[model samples]
Target chain A: MYLFSAHNITKNYAAHTALKNVSIDVSAQTIFGLLGPNGAGKTSLIRIINQITAPDEGELYFNGEKLKPHHISLIGYLPEERGLYKKMKVGEQALYLAQLKGVPKAEALKKLKYWFEKFEILDWWNKKVEELSKGMQQKIQFIVTILHEPKLLIFDEPFSGFDPINVNLLKEEILNLRNNGATIIFSTHNMESVEELCDNIALINKAEKILDGKVHEIKNTYKANIFEIGYNKQEINFNEIVPQSYEILSDIHQNGISKIQIKIPADEMPNQLIKYLIPHMEMHSFNEILPSMNDIFIQKVNEQKQKSF
Target chain B: MIFLFKKLTNRSKNPFKSITMKKIRLIIQREYLSRVKKRSFIIMTILGPVLMASIWIVPFFLATMSDEKKVVSVVDETGVFVDKFESTAKILFVYETDLEKSRADLTKEKYSAVLYICKPTNSIPDHAMLYYSDKSPGIITQSYISNAMQTILKNNLLINAHNISKEDFDLINRTNIKLNTEDIRTGKKSYTEIKTALGIFSGILIYFFIFMYGAQVMRGVIEEKTSRIVEVIISSVKPFQLMMGKIVGIALVGLTQFALWILLTFFIITSLQIAKPDVFKSPKTEQAFDAGQKIPSADQIQLQKLQNQEIKEMLTGIFEIDYGLMILQFLFYFLAGYLLYASLFASIGAAVDSEADTQQFMLPITIPLLFAIIMSNFVINNPDGPVAFWLSIIPLTSPIIMMVRIPFGVPVEQVYLSMGLLILGFIATTWVAGRIYRTGILMYGKKVSYRELWKWLRY
Candidate 1:
């Protein structure tokens, strides 16, 4: 069963509509990547799910039941622009935030101690937040978000300020949480992390969802029928031998080896192009080219931008 | 089990109704503990009493301390005043016939000043020019010399015009009376001076708490907003609850500080009283007069005695008040006044992005408080005047003005009405502030204005 879903949510501010009929389903024990460009209503949808804001029209469900206030305790949110009290001690602030999420004070302290030790920041327990570096503060914020052992966690731009090493550590922790039966929804501009971590993604463009599927399926759905061929020959012109069903996109010859990219019609496949080229050229290799999520995101957003203009 | 099931079902149906209390408690705990732990709060709490006790203790200590004797050489050009300047507690007059000799002797540092008493002309010339090398003598020295001359002149005129003896003249001049007012309703008589002091004390106390604690609430909100911790906090608790937590938390801080001040002040005052019982006693005569010099007449001694009696009466009048009830009402008015102003301050804090942005909106909130404080002086003077009555009824000004009238014995119906209206005012402002706070906390980087605040209220 899906752990959470926002069905047809719409939100309007005084001067703008932040979200319009955007719906997303987050499955259990899986990472849901909310992909969008800036100002594409990702935060709006997250806020709606968190109930920080009420949708002008929508319904929310958790585990196939209607969402309610008690569900708030079950979900932890790390907002894009999160902070801690500058003058407050690190452990005290973490414990306070944990208790705010409904964890009892003793449990909060115990959990915070464990997390502090795990992060190797136990020495920072009595230090003020202002005394910590930005990266260190982000670690504290991360610990606060997960200290309650919430059923679902939402992280927005969670990797913005981290070094690569810490980013990898954070990604590992996030995946570990998912493996331990907690659902996660994270939003970011890092398509590489999305490819590495997300099981499912929904791409939003201009307050609307343009693509939604399992990550591999979405990548496959946007792939063109193109193949790259390498031949033993020094040079080759495809104009004479290529059929109308296939056309050469690029041809390059270097050091007695020839490489050519050919696009096939919708009715044709990469195998058919290979079949067409086999008679004229000795094939060293043939491989299909699939678009990355970054290309897909740009193409979809640009296409939607064109459609609107 | 049945009750638990019913509660679960009800909460599921209307969760918001019951979801706020636990969160609000957490927020209040954070605010109160964080502020109480701050070094500034601890320092202010300890310093407040020392400062307040100094107001009453410093003057009394100075009055009772050992006085340095000052000798003034009187170069009396008017022979009628030679050897007539009587010595008092600090000042000693020595007759000097030669003005040049006195002027030359002045540098010896044995004398404080040289008093040149010019002969009385057609009118009482601004008498007695005083000269010193470096420092100027105090006003008391000149006033004392002039007063002695006036007394002698008045006695001479009375003796010549009425053919009366000096004893009769002395008896007539020593008249001392005090005004006592009786309440028509209770038939109880009391001094007007005590009532005025009590009225002003209560009014200023209310005024003080509202300003001090109200600004604290505003500063706390601004800190949360600027530090960007408010969003994390408000996500767990409602904005209204957050605002309320801060308001009540800071109010408790103010109350704690006030209680500490009162307790410490009383302790310090009593300790000093026990340590030096004569600190507040009657003034003593300690000047060294020449053995052959004339002493001050009995009339001058009687005058000093009358002044001492006045001070003793003022002290006794302070003890005559019904302190328990006054303190209870003071707490009520202080809390109500604080609530009313703190809500307005909180809204101002939420509407602005920084402390610098608060200046534009501060005027409207502060005007009524300033007006009430300024009008409280008038209220103390005329507690039954129309202005005082109307101001004590208006919710904004009533918190202060009513306290001023209460110690002078306000009508019971008016107190209840004022209290009711003040509570209503607090609730109304809190609701309005909650609206502004909810909208403004989430809004960042925008320059907010009064018009924007109004729109937020509508939202």
Candidate 2:
């Protein structure tokens, strides 16, 4: 079942359109990647979901109900430019934020202690936020963002300031949260993480949603009939063995090995190419090459840019 | 997550109909606690009363401390003014024959000044000159010398030319008049001076507090914006809630500080009076006591009775002031004025990315407050005049101008009208400020102009 969804949301600033008829649905217990380039209205959509700014024209539903102020406590948001009160104590600020999210004071303190201990930042509890390093502060922010254990958490560039180890830690925690039945909307420029973590994604560009689906499904749709073959060098030229109907995209030979990429016709089977190449070359490996999310993002955005002109 | 889900289901059954005051209370608690716990607040709380008490006590000490006597040498060219100069506690007069000798003595610092009386060319001397080596004689000494000389010359003229006896001249010059002012309606003495002082005191205090606390509210906003914490906060609570929470929080801080200052000032002044009773005595009372010591025994009782009567009149005058009404009005205006100005300050702070950028917006807010202060003197002089009436009615200037007219017994209806208008003004400004603040806090890096602010208000 869908945990949260935005329908035909449109938002506008004074002179520019921030969002235009954008729609997205996040299913329960899944991480939904919100992918876009800079200034592509991704932040605007996230803000609408958080109710930080209401959409000029649209509706939002949380847990199959119309979104309201009470829904605020159910959703947690970590903005791209998130910060804590610099002069406030670490534990104090965390507890305050949790309380603002509608957690009882005692419960907030208990949760804060658990998170602070889990993150190994218990010693820094009394220290002022400004005294902590940037990564340390980000850790505190991350803890506060999920302290209330919100059912729907929205993270905007969640891993921006973290080291690789902390990034992995955060990734594990995000996945762990999803396993516990929380839906997450992850917005980022990092496509590799999206490929690894996201169950589904919606690609927005120029204030419009151009693509969205399950991760594997979208990849399958964008995949061409291209395959890479790796083999040992043989007497016959590897290029000559390929059918004339098939297009050879690249051929490279080095260190007694040959690697070639070829695009087969849609009418032809991939096994037919293997059948033709078996007798001519030593077959070590053969695999179809699918487009990475990074490649698809750039290609789609570029295509949209061209269409706009 | 399970807990949140359950809570969500429960809340979704009955969604919030309005912005939650609970969240705003949390914000207010944080804002108020963070400031009240600061070292600066503590220091100021303690030091404010000390400074205020010193303002009351320092002048009295200074007045009684500077009792150094001044000696003036008289060099009368015509010998008509010999033995005529009288010596008092502050100034002493001595006759000298040689003008050049007295001038030299003045240069040698033997005398404070040398008064040279020129011989009369006609009925009276045309001009008289006084010389000193350095630091000319004070106004008191100068006026004293001139008055003594005038009396001596006039008496001489009266006795020689008009054939009037000294007794008749003395009796004629002793006609002193005293005017008493009373409130015709209540048959009470009208203490215009005391009331004027109270009105101006309260007016200036309100002005000072509004600016002091209003700037604090602005700085708090800028801190939240520049620190980038506002986004995180507004996600949980509305921008209006956050803004009002901050304004109200800082106002409580201001009220707390003011209350502490009043209590502490009273305590300090009273303890000081108990410790040093002589210092608390007015200089006039002390002088009367000194004169009593030197005068006859019977006159001492009379002087004491006169001093007691003066003190009693002053006490009665103080008791006649409507302290309850004054305090109530002060509190209302202080809070109302602060809320009005603080919301504007908060909007300005949100519109700018840094404190330096607030300069362009501060002028419009400060102009009315400054104009009210400048017109306060006129208001005090003519409380019921058209200017005072209109200024006291306008909400922007009324907090201060109306306060200036309050002690002069402003009509009840006009005060109510002014108060009602001030509340309406506060609500209106808060609405505009909330609109601008919500949009401005989210915008960054761009220089905001007035046109941009107008657009934000519309948004």
The prediction achieving the highest TM-score against the true structure is 1
Candidate 2, B313-387: lDDT as tens digits: 778888999898899999999999999889999999999999999999999999999999999999888889999
User: DockQ (Cα-based) per candidate?
Assistant: 0.55, 0.65
lDDT of 1 by residue, B101-210 (tens): 88888887867889887877754444667889677887776687678877766665678656999778878988778676777876666667778877887788888888
User: Model 2 has how many clashing residue pairs?
Assistant: 0
Off by over 4 Å in 2: A232-236, A252-258, A280-284, B1-4, B11-19, B66-178, B285-312
Q: RMSD of candidate 1 to the true fold? A: 3.5
Best by DockQ: 2
Worst 10 residues of 2 chain B by lDDT: B291-300
**Scored by CA lDDT, what does every candidate get?**
0.83, 0.89
Write down the DockQ of candidate 1: 0.55
Write down the TM-score of every candidate: 0.92, 0.90
